[model samples]
Target: MRKKLKEKISEALSSVLPITVIVLLLSFTLAPMPIGTLLLFLLGAAMLIVGMGFFSLGADMAMMPIGEQMGRKLGGRWKLIAVAVICFLIGAMVTIAEPDLQVLARQVPAVPDAVIILAVAAGVGVFLVVSMLRTRFNLPLGPTLIALYTGVFLLSIFVPNAFLAVAFDSGGVTTGPITVPFLMALGTGMASIKGRDEDNFGMVALCSVGPILAVMLLGLCYQSTEVSYTPFAIPSVFDSQDVGAQFLQGLPDYMKEVALGLLPIILFFAVFQLASIRLKRRAVIKIIVGIGYTYVGLVLFLTGANIGFMPAGYYLGTTLAALPQYWMLVPIGMVVGYFIVAAEPAVHVLNRQVEDVTSGAIPQKAIGLALSIGVAVSIGLAMLRVCLGIPIYYLLVPGYAVALLLTRCVPRIFTAIAFDSGGVASGPMTATFLLPLTMGACEALGRDILTDAFGVVAMVAMTPLITIQLLGLIYQRKIRRTRDVTQAEEREIEFVDEIIDYNEEVEL
Candidate 1:
């Protein structure tokens, strides 16, 4: 256990260190920030590394096991209605507790936070059930995504133009850290039924869709009021004590939120344990310890991200954006975007699972690179939207059109992983940092904040669908060229070789 934690932390440090360096370089060169802000960011970066380490270990120990066990139990003898109800409850519960969703909710003014939360939660709940049912019935994922996404686009027509970005972003943030491991495990467990585990990759993708549809419908109903934005305050620190105090003051709020965020899943696991799938005592204790690690890690992570990185991202966006060469935001943002995806907690979870599911056929580094390229392109495009007022639909309609079209072209697993990657990639990092970064630039440029600033997460989510599918296309062609011969083919070739050998020997 200690060795694994060390490895996890080391991996996290390497992943996080680059972004820290990038932020520092920008601060010193292009976007000088206040001393206090830099100090806070440094502190946040440190905490994020430690927190990611703990959280990764904890997820392996706790969340993954609980989800798998629950899934296995559900795969047996449960009625379809019962399964649906359970899925809905779990989906809504985890989503309501997602800190990323809460952060996103606090930023939007189109609806009350409670309304947005409930609406998005309900959306996730319904789609989670759909995901499981599809797995149970052995349905093809491609056409389903095409049909659902088509419906989502049709619903967008009814949504007001100004509020469209928020609707799409809801889909991205719904599968944040708290939701990813569990929902993914649940999907794996569902797919494990009868050993038909080939199609376990699309639960997060389907769940991601629910929130967009839900939020779009909400946008139409709530369009009567103009959307509003409240600027997040930058901290003031004059001394070391003030830096310590800032962290001290911020700790309790995140502690409460993280605690609340984890409670539902923990409690559900407890109930499920008491009722069914009761494991050995040692296993339960290990899970409890993992849960502890998860809680502490999350609290620290949220504090660092919101208190530290948030201000830095906002400051950079505002400062650099005011320059005459504001379009430079594209390259700088792309550079930042490359490493930022590595820092996303849920993204780590997704990459690790993909490697495990594919049995090392798809290495972590490959998926990481594909995701990095996708996010880099996304950041560049998002900056373009910020620099010039591009409509969200201009990018989204064609992006989804291409993504859905690629589903027919790639292997089913790649399509699943690609769609799921879109959601996982737009996690806390995108919500807390990139969203603020783009919005800050948009605000500085005097563009409409709602239209320009709001769609960065949607952009972040969209590109991976294409990039990963492209990777799959490459993998498919490579395999076709170098496929392993079947036993019959090998035997026939050997027989021909033996016949040649016999003729040669007899002639000699």
Candidate 2:
């Protein structure tokens, strides 16, 4: 356990250190921030490192097992209606508790936070049922995604344009840190019983869809024209004591929030364990420890992110965008996007799972690089849109069209991984940091926040669908080449044997 904790901390540091360095460099060179803000950012980075370490370990120890056990048991004996209800409850519970969803809910001005949260949660519940049914019936994922997304776009036309980006962003943030590990494990457990390799993935991808559709419908109903944008206030701290006080002040609220977020999951596990799971006492004890770790980690993580990184992101975006050379936003955003995705804890979880599931054929290093490149391109495009005031649909429609087109060209497993990667890439960092950065830039540019600044997550989510599928295309080609080479070698060996036999017959 100590070794695992140490390893997770090391991974967290490596993941976070790059982004921290980048932010510091920007503060010093390009967008100089106050000393207090810088200190707060550094302190936040420390908490993030520690928090991610504990959180990753907790998810592996507790959430994954619970999800897997439930999936295996449910897949075997539960009636369809029962399965649907349980899945809905699980989806709604986890989503409501998702930190990313809460962050987004706070950002949107038109609807009450509870309304957005509930709407998004209910959406996830419905789609989770759809995803489970798809896995059980062995339905084609590509056609289903195409049809669903087609419906989403069609619905978007009637919904307020301002809400379109928010609707899509909902999908990306729904499959965040808390949701991904459990849902992915659940899919794996369910797929194991279904006797299909590809079914283990695409559950996150499908579940992500529910929020977009639900939010779009909600947008139509709410029909609010004005969105209020409130920027994070940069902290004023003159000393180390002040930084300590700031973090300490904010810590308890997040602690309570995280605890409330975790309670439902713990209770659900307990009820299910008593009713059907009946896990061993030793296992239950381990999970209890894990839940404790998860609680502490999330509190620290959210506190650090909200207090430290949020202001830095907003300040940096505003300062950079306000520069005479405002065009620098594109490249700078691209660079930040490249590294920030690596910092997202959920991205680490998804990459590790993908590597494990593919038995290292799809290497973690490869997935990381592909995701970075995809996110970089997406951020560049997002900054461009923010700068130029382009409609998001202009990029999204073509992007999804190409992603769906590639579905026919790659293996189904890769398709599933690609789509799931899209959701994973746009986790907490995008919601807490990138979204604020975009909003800041839009505010500086005097553009409509609702339309211009709202879709960074959607863009982050969209590009991975194409890039990973492109990686899949490459994988398929390599597989075909290897097969051809092996066949050629076999034929050559047969031809050599035939010559040897002919020579022997001639001698006879």
Candidate 3:
């Protein structure tokens, strides 16, 4: 156990260290902040690394197993309606558990946070029902996604522009750290009963769609107004002691937040254990310990992200935009984006599951690289929008169109994984750091934060659909070529053997 925990922390160090280095470089060269702020940022990075490490381990221990067990129960001979209702409840409850959703909920100005969160949860529940039914009935994911997203765009017409961006961004944030492992594992459990690779992958994809549709509908009901965003306040600290005090002050709030976020899941699992799925006592204890790890990890991670990273991202963005060479935002953002996706806790969950689901036919490394490139492009585009004020629809409409188009072009399993990657790529890290960065830049440039800076997560979500599918195309072509070569060699060997056999017969 100690070895495994050490390994998890080590993996997190590698994942987080590059982004930290980049931020340090930026601080020293292009976007210097006060030494106190930099020190806070460094402390936050350290906490982030440790928190993610423990969180990843906890997910493996608790969330994945719970999801798999629940999925097994779901695979029973329940009526379709029963399954749908259960799935809806699970989907809604699990979404509310996501810390990333809370982060996003705070940013949108006019809507009550509870209203937005509940609406998004309802959307997830409904779509998760669809996902389960589709799996049970053997439906094609591509057509279903196309139909739903088509409706999404149609609904976007009625939504206020500010709300539209938030609506789309909500899709990305919904499938965050707490939700990803469970959803992915649920898909795996379903597949274990009676499913293919595609079945093991598309739950997250389907669930991601629910929030966008729900939020857009909510926007239609609500009145539009000029939304105001208060940018991050740079910290003022005299000494290192004050910085420690700041983190200590923030820790209790996050502990309570994490506790509340986890309570539903723990209670639900308890009920589930007593009612439907009983496990060994030892297993239950392990899960309990894992939950403890998750709580501790999340509290640390949130405290760091909210207190340390937010201000740094804000200052960096504002300082860079204030420069004469503001075009540097695009290139700098691209670099940051490339490395940042690796640091996302949900991303590692997806990558691990993808590799495990495919039995390493698709590697973790390949998924990581594809996701990095996709996020890099997305962030660059997002920064460009901040500088030039491009409406998000201009990019999202065509981007999703192409993504939906590729659903038909690539292998179906890859399509599932690709869409799932879109959601995974835009987890807590994107919401916490990248969104703040864009918001800061928008504030500095006097752009509308709602319309201009809000949809960066959506952009982060969209590009992976295309890039991973493109990777799939490459994978398919390679397989075809290898098959052709093997067939050719087999034919040649058969001809040569026939020749030898004929000669031996003649000699006999």
Candidate 4:
């Protein structure tokens, strides 16, 4: 246990340090922030590192096992209806508990929080069913995605323009820290039952689609023109004590929210344990401990992010945009985006999973680099949109269309990884930090928040589809080159052997 804790802490520090350095550099340079804000951000960074360490450890200990066992047991059941219903319920329940989704829900003003939350949850539920069916029936994922996204775009056409970015952002946020570990493990568990390699992936990818469709449909039903965004309020702190007080004040509220979010999952697991799992007493005790760790870690993480980092991001964006060379926002955002993705806890989970599933064929380093580049480009583009006032659809339509087209050229596993990476890349940090940053910049540039600032998550989600698949194309090329060399070597050896045999015959 001590070893695992140490390892997680080390990983968390490494993951978080790059972004911390980047933010500090910005604060000291082009985007000079208030000293109080800087202090708060530094404190928040500490909490984030520790929180991520505990959360990752707890997820390994508890969330993965719970999800895998549930999926395995449920997948084996003969009753399709029962399996579908249970999967749907689990999907909806976990999504409702997602911290990232909650953050996004609070930001969008046109729809009530509950209405958007329920709608997004329902989307997850329905799509989870579709994912299960796809796995069971061996449906082609590429085509299904094409069809689903086609429908998404079709629906977008009818929905209010303001809701377009929000709808897509809903999809990205739903598959966050809490949702990824469980859902990925569940997919793995179900795939194990099927004994197919490809089945394990694309669960998160499919599940992501649910919220987009659901939120878009909701937009059509409840169109509101009064879309407004509340900017992040910079906390005033005169001294260290005030800074401490700020975090302390926010801590309890987040603790309560995290507890409420986790309660449903714990209760569901308990019922599952009683009904089906019957895990050993020792195992159950371990999971309970893990749950406690997860709860504490999440509270700290959310408190630090919302109370500390968010305001810093907002302030930074506004400060940078107000500069004479406001175009610097693009390169500055790109650099931040590159490093910021490393701060996403769920991203680490997804990278580890991809590595394990591929037996290290796809290294975690490669995944990390690919995602970082993708997010960098996404954020750069997002800033460009905010600076120049470009419609999101102008970017999104071509982006998705290109992503769908690439599905034909790349290996299936890359497609799954790419799409899944999209969801994983846009975790809590994106919602809490980048979205606020974009909103601040948008406000500074005198652009509409709903139309301009709303799509950062979606942009984060979209670019990985192209980048990872591009990685896939490169990977495929390497494989082919290796194969060709091996084949040529074999042919040369055969030729040599034939010549030797003829000489032997002549000598004889």
Q: Give the alpha carbon lDDT tens digit for every residue of 94-190 in model 4.
A: 8888766776677567779898899889889999999999988888778899999998898788988877887888889788777887888888888
lDDT of 1 by residue, 1-508 (tens): 8899999899889999999999999888888889988998899999999999999999999989998899888766799999899999999999999877876677567688899899889999999999988888889899999999999999888787766787788888778888888888888888888565456689999999988988788788877445666766677787778988999998999998888889999988998899988999999999999999888778878888888888889889999899989999999999999999999988888888889888899999989999999999999999999898889899999999999999998999999999999988998888778888987898889988888988899999999999999999999998876665565688899999999999999999
Backbone clash pairs for candidate 3 read none
Q: Which parts of model 1 have CA positions greater than 4 angstroms off?
A: 107-110, 484-508
For all predicted structures, in order, the TM-scores are 0.95, 0.97, 0.96, 0.97
lDDT of 2 at 109: 75
Model 2 C-alpha lDDT per residue in residues 1-508, reported as the tens digit of each score: 9999999999999989999999999998989998888888898989999999999999888877877888897677689999999999999998888766776676567788899899889989898999889988889898898898888878888987767887888889778777788898899889889887678889899999988987787778878754555655667888889999999999988887778777777888888899988989999999999888887778878888888888788888899999999889999999999998888877877887888777788999888988999999999999999899999999999999999999988999888988998998988788778988888888899988778888899999999999989988888899999999999999999999999999999999
| Model 4 misplacement above 4 A | 106-112
**Cα lDDT over the full model 4:** 0.87
The TM-score between candidate 1 and the true structure equals 0.95
Error of 3 at 95 (Å): 2.4
Looking at candidate 1, what is the lDDT of residue 418?
Answer: 93
User: Over the stretch 360-393, how does candidate 3's per-residue lDDT look in tens digits?
Assistant: 9999999999999999999999999999999999
